[model samples]
Target: MKIATFNVNGINGRLPRLLEWLAEAKPDAVCLQELKAPGDRFPEAAIRDAGYGAIWQGQARWNGVAILARGADPVETRRGLPGDPEDAQARYIEAAVGGVLIGGLYLPNGNPRPGPKFDYKLAWTERLLAHAAGLIEAGVPAVLAGDFNIIPTDQDVYKPERWRDDALFAPEAKAAFQRLLDQGWTDAIRALHPDAIIYTFWDYWRNAFGRDAGLRIDHLLLSPSVAGRLAKAGVDRAVRGRDKASDHAPAWLTLRKA
Candidate 1:
């Protein structure tokens, strides 16, 4: 099975590009983030026409997440992450497809550090850690994939000194990411090509993409049961250079058949 994650930026505005990538990549399962649309407004017809079934949790003009399964609909598991009743954002979605539990996430960007947004980001990470531990203990084949909004190490960023104070590069966020890894989730891309500078996101300004100034924020993490099946992993960097493309390219992994 092949699994991929992409942050489309805005689904409606980028539907054409998204469909094009889907048709070309043909991943068996896809985790999508940042739909930037309300639930009722999701373009079901467009997605269906592309030969995929999807379940989305959307919020108007902001965060959203979805899971797409080629040739069939993903069975819904949960719409939002637990542990926070007051928190409401379409940033997390989980589903079951082809015997694998997939968790699609759009972690908070948390810009302008030393503020409330940054605090929320850390708290959310805590909740995610707790829930991820349960998934690990459950002993199911699972994947946690999406825009993590984290630069795991200085090596993952093009210019470490430039982004040292940014939320994505903050020590708190990186430490939280470590907590997840300590629970034993395999960072598939890093594991596959250790020491290589692979990036999935590039900003639109300053010719970041043109200059290859990018960050490796999007990720596909595998549980113990699924990590051993990993065969290949990569980033579709060409997609980020396409017309009307999202800032993020798709990060994908191939698994040996059970």
Candidate 2:
């Protein structure tokens, strides 16, 4: 199956661009982040018309996540990440498509380090780690894909020096990301193209996209049960340059069928 992850930025504003990409790329399943719309306001009909059915966790205008499966309706396996009853941001949604578990997440962007937002980001990462441990224990083939909002390593970002103080690439953030990897999940993109400078997200400021100044924040992490089946992975960088396109491009991986 061809599985992809993309941060569409905003579902309503990027509908046309999203449809165009979806038709051209034709992935079997897609995990979307940053829907930025309420559940009632999601363009369900439009998405259905595009030949996919989705399960989404939505907030008004901030964090949101969804999983869209082509040719199959996704069965929701879980909603928000557990461990924090007070946590209410629509950041996580998981589902099963043809026996493959897929999860989409929009991790918080904790900017202005040494602040409350940064603390919340770390706490959220801990919660996600706890939840991921549970999923790993379930022993199912799964892929966690989305905008993690954490620049994992120097290789994952354009310049380590430039992002040193940035929240996304902070030492604490990188450690949290490493903790996830240590849990027996394979970073699918890195597994396929270890040395390639593949990037999936760029800022819409100061001509970042045009300059190829981007970061590989969006990712597809596969459990060991599914990692051996990995066939291919890539970033649709062209999509980031399209008219009315999102700051992020689609990152995808294809896996051999069991």
Candidate 3:
């Protein structure tokens, strides 16, 4: 099975680009972030025509998440992250597709740090850690895949020093990512290309994509059982340079079918 994740930026505005990619890449499953549309406005007809069934947690003009399964309907699992009843952002969604539990998330950006937004980001990650632990204990075949909005490590970005002050690369954020790895989730792209300088996102300004200045934020982290089947993984970097493209390229992994 080929599983992929993409931060579409704006689903309604970018539907054409997304549809084109879906036709060409043909991933068996995909997790999408940044829908930037309300629940009632999701382009269900277009996606259905593209031959994928999807379930989404939609919000207006900010954050949203969705899971799409090629040729089948995704069985809805969960709508939001646990441990936060008051939190109402549409940033997390989960579904069962082809017998695998897939968690799709769009973690908070938390820019202009040292404030409430940054605090929320940290707290959100804590919640994620707790839930991820449960998933690990259950030992199900699963994947946590999405735009994590985290740089993870110096090796995961180009010119790390330039982003040191950024929230995505902040020590606290990186530590949270480490805690997830400590729980035994395998970072699929890193596992496949341990020493490569792989990246999934590039800023639109300053010719970042042209100069190969990018960051590896979007990711597919696998539970142990699912990790064992990992065969190949990579970023579709070319997609980022296309006309009317999103800043993020699709990060994908292929696993052996049982």
TM-scores, all models, native as reference = 0.99, 0.98, 0.99
What is the TM-score ranking, best to worst?
A: 1, 3, 2
Instruction: List model 1 lDDT by residue over 124-193, tens digit each.
Output: 8888899899999999999999999999999899989999999999999999999899999999999989
Which residue segments of model 2 deviate by more than 4 Å?
A: none
TM-score of predicted model 2?
0.98
Scored by CA lDDT, what does every candidate get? Answer: 0.95, 0.91, 0.94
Q: How large is the C-alpha RMSD of every model relative to the true structure?
A: 0.6, 0.8, 0.6
Better of 1 and 2 by lDDT: 1
Which ranges in model 1 have alpha carbons more than 4 Å from their true place? none
By lDDT, is 2 or 3 better?
A: 3
Off by over 4 Å in 3: none
Q: Which candidate is the best by lDDT?
A: 1
**All candidates in order of lDDT, best leading:** 1, 3, 2
